[model samples]
Target chain A: MKTLVIISHPNILESSSQQFLIKAIPHHFDVTVHHLENEYPDWNINVAKEQKLLSEHDRIIFQFPFYWYSSPALLKHWQDMVYTEDFAFHARGKALRGKEFGLVLSVGINEAEYQAGGREMFSISELTRPFQATAEKLGMTYLKPFSIFQFGYMTDEQRFQLAIHYQQVLTREKDNSLEAKEKWIMEQLTNMDKASLSTDDKIVLENAVESLKNNRHTIDELKLILEQMW
Target chain B: MKTLVIISHPNILESSSQQFLIKAIPHHFDVTVHHLENEYPDWNINVAKEQKLLSEHDRIIFQFPFYWYSSPALLKHWQDMVYTEDFAFHARGKALRGKEFGLVLSVGINEAEYQAGGREMFSISELTRPFQATAEKLGMTYLKPFSIFQFGYMTDEQRFQLAIHYQQVLTREKDNSLEAKEKWIMEQLTNMDKASLSTDDKIVLENAVESLKNNRHTIDELKLILEQMW
Candidate 1:
């Protein structure tokens, strides 16, 4: 399924978090990054063009930095102007039905600060109810949001892992079972460009693939035994 | 304390709810109704002017229809541009500290639908956490929001009562005691122009003022007795 990531920021050029996210998305993945502020300088959005874009993608993501505990103003403006009654929610407006909606947020606050007694005094999930309600009203599947907290402190290796996790969220189906993850890993290995790998790199890749297959076989056997007993 | 009601609607001329709110605000009350769209048609907000307006008011209310489970884009834009980090928050900025912040929202859906197992499946309080978080971060007192649900279904009498409730939220202190309410009633009666009333109207107004004072006395006595017993 194709994914559309609608990115919005007041100043994109200076934002390292936004830049990292854009660079992290795999080139081969079927994802489109639509920069909102760059596209509509005057806030005059084309409804037909936006609706057509929505219709083409199976999954839609709103990606932005958390400003004032919510998204930047332009993204909210986009929702107000594009998702009208006749096109998004009325009797003849089930155009967004069965589509998947999610958020990719970059929070400047610490993760521990979002809690009952913490500085923020609420969870990120609690704060994002408005987006969930919007998705529910439009008959879309609401996916768990992906949040990056305190981007200034992350190491390079962690950022690379975040990118891989982000790619899975965009491309893979919404399943967290061990069997599904193993299947996804096998598919990724199959899709790798082996011809471009050096001899040493190819040997390491083959060994990793063999180890993953052995783990999957053991996991399936254990699952079969447990299911039979139950 | 003075109050400022910043009203925002895409088309204010056509909204009966907005009109009713503006008309219902007591003329003698120390309140200013600032229409956001009319004030900034070009979207270029004057930061100094807005901060000055905010500093003058004790109670700051955002009055608008609940669009997409939140305020319209203009309100969010106002927040982003006007509420600068150096002016509203940070080490030296405490301009809004200890002031009251609240929302007056007109919801299109039914009240009963906002609950578990209901159509909306979430209360209004649960949905407005973002606003609450904003108020907390700014060191402002967050008041319980005043929501007008299903305006098209409200009767004239209900609307009038709603106006009274709205007025109480704006002008009164953050106290819900019966004695406080009775005191407010007496104050409103005192503020009335008794000279403009006919003989019968004057007698009725006099009786209401007397009754409210008597109730306040009775409430104080009861509270004293309960305190002694406990």
Candidate 2:
């Protein structure tokens, strides 16, 4: 699916997580990264341009660093302006109906701080109800939010895993099944540029792909059996 | 108690509810009405000035029309910028600690549209969780939010009642008990401009005040009994 990641940070250059996520867009997935602060320095969001962008994408993500338990001022202003009543909540037709909506949040504090008995005293889900309501009103499918807490504390391996997980959130077929995961991983592997890899690395990659193909075949047979039983 | 009702409306002149609220401050209460849009036409809030105002008030009410299930963008930005770490959440002591925080919301939609099986699908309390969490974090008391729904649909009697109820929300002593309500009503009645009223109206007002004084005395006697029993 084509995805649009709208980044709403006051200072994009200073945010490491924003850079990482922008660079982590899956190679084979059609993605557009629009940074709000960079696009509208004067805080005048062009509604027509934004509406056109929303029309072209099936999955839209609002990516931002959480400020005071919500998005920054510009993003809030953008929502207030661009999502006009006639365009978003029309009686005959909503412009964004049937589109997928999601939030990619980068919080400065640790994840543990956002729970009962924690310092924040509210789950991220509870704090983000407004966005969920907005999606429901517009007849959009709201995806489970992807939150990265304390990105500065992440190790290299963790960062790598986070990138892959982020890509899965963006490109998956709205399923979390092992079959679906394998399908996505297999696609990524098959689309890899092997020209830059060493001979040993290419061999390893080929073995991995072969193993995935066998697993995919076995899963298909199991599904067929289950279908027959039903 | 001193109150700082920070009004955050883009067009204050256009909002009848806002204007009604501005004229609803109690007679004997110390209230400073600061309209953010009027004060900061450039949208740049003076942190030092806001900090000073916050410091001086025992009650801080964020009065605004609900925009997308939260305050307008400027209010969000005000919270973000004015409530800085060194000032609001400092290690030494929070500046606004022990103060009461409340929300005076004016929703354009009907009240019934914000409950289970309704179009909004969330109560005001649930949707305004961020403000509660913020108050908790800063060691302030989060008062029950006061909402005026579809103010334009209200009758003149309803509007007058709203003004009184709005005053009670702003000036009540953080309780909803009958005794507390009586005490507040007594205060307002005692402080009224009786000189402007007709002689018959004056007599009626005096009798009401006399009845309230007796009720207050009786409540005190009951409290004494309960205290002695305890």
Q: Find the candidate with the highest DockQ and give its number.
A: 1
DockQ list for all candidates:
0.86, 0.80
How does candidate 2 score on lDDT? 0.90
Candidate 2 chain A worst ten-residue window by lDDT: A84-93
Q: Which ranges in model 1 have alpha carbons more than 4 Å from their true place?
A: A193-196, A225-230, B218-230
Model 1 collision count:
0
lDDT of 2 at A109: 89
Q: Model 2 - which docking category?
A: medium
Show model 2 residue runs off by greater than 4 Å. Answer: A223-230, B26-28, B221-230
Candidate 2: deviation at residue B167, Å?
Answer: 0.4
- Fnat for each model: 0.88, 0.68
Top candidate on lDDT is: 1
Cα-based RMSD of the predictions, in order? 1.8, 1.9
lDDT of 1 by residue, B1-230 (tens): 99999998989999988998888888889999999899999888888999999999999999999998899999999999888988899898989999999999999899999888878878989889999999999999999999999888999899989988998988988999776787787777899767788999998888888887787788789989999999
Please give the CA lDDT of all the candidate structures.
Answer: 0.91, 0.90
